[model samples]
Target: MTGANGVPEGFVPLPTSAFVEHLGGLYHAPEAPEHTFGMRVGPEHANVRGRAHGGFLATAVDVATSRGARAAMGDGSGVSTVTMTMDYLAPVDVGEWIQLVTTVDRVGGRTVFATCRVTAGDRLVARGSVVLARIRPRA
Candidate 1:
């Protein structure tokens, strides 16, 4: 079930998030399944200038960071991104395969912090960090 870039079929490891699906973002799951995710830039994900939009990039950042936090904390309850900061290093053109490498920085009582480095092959796309709050377990 490998795709053009060798990503397995239905690679998106996380739950079917509305926004992530809207962006056509998917990840490499059942393989690494942690701390890393990827997406192929599509027309819908592009801005008027035919490049990746800031919102799309930011959403990818949030998604990857959240997944990383979940992997590190091993809490299936869920992770809510509280805050995020992104710095666009370069523009990603359409049809490029982008990968986000995320790391969980720390886990507090309820907050988890993580960072991600985005790249398209060898090109830097953006760098970002996010803080996520662990969802409480339901009774």
Candidate 2:
């Protein structure tokens, strides 16, 4: 099922900062844990070259995979990216709805490792991996 704006049915808009809100609305897919994050590409997301900017895509991946890692922490803990790498496979055009499909590779006491594939429809547009440091509350 899909939403009115073509967003998938299970996805709900995620509250974000002004910068992210301007980039494009972020979505959380609660029903599909693997597909925890998503966003729709708009003309504003395009670069001067008329494709989705690499920086924007990188930001989306970082946010999405960090959410995956945080969920793996299993204590409602937050996470900060320790390191991240992204490989651009294809150019995503405006009007494409992209999904960030993530896998939690490993979970440890202080760190989590995860990978995400950015897909636009049937195309795999990018892949990213991240190592996140668990952010525990100061006690």
> What's the TM for model 2?
0.90
What is the total number of backbone clashes in candidate 2?
0
Name the best candidate (by lDDT): 2
lDDT score, residue 92, model 2? 95
lDDT of 1: 0.81
RMSD (Å) per prediction: 2.8, 1.7
- Kindly give the stretch of ten consecutive residues in candidate 2 with the minimal lDDT sum: 67-76
List the candidates' TM-scores in order. 0.84, 0.90
- Per-residue error (Å), model 2, residue 126: 0.3
Candidate 2 regions with alpha-carbon error over 4 angstroms: none
Q: CA lDDT of each candidate?
A: 0.81, 0.86
Clashes by residue pair, model 1: none
TM-score of candidate 1 against the unseen true structure: 0.84
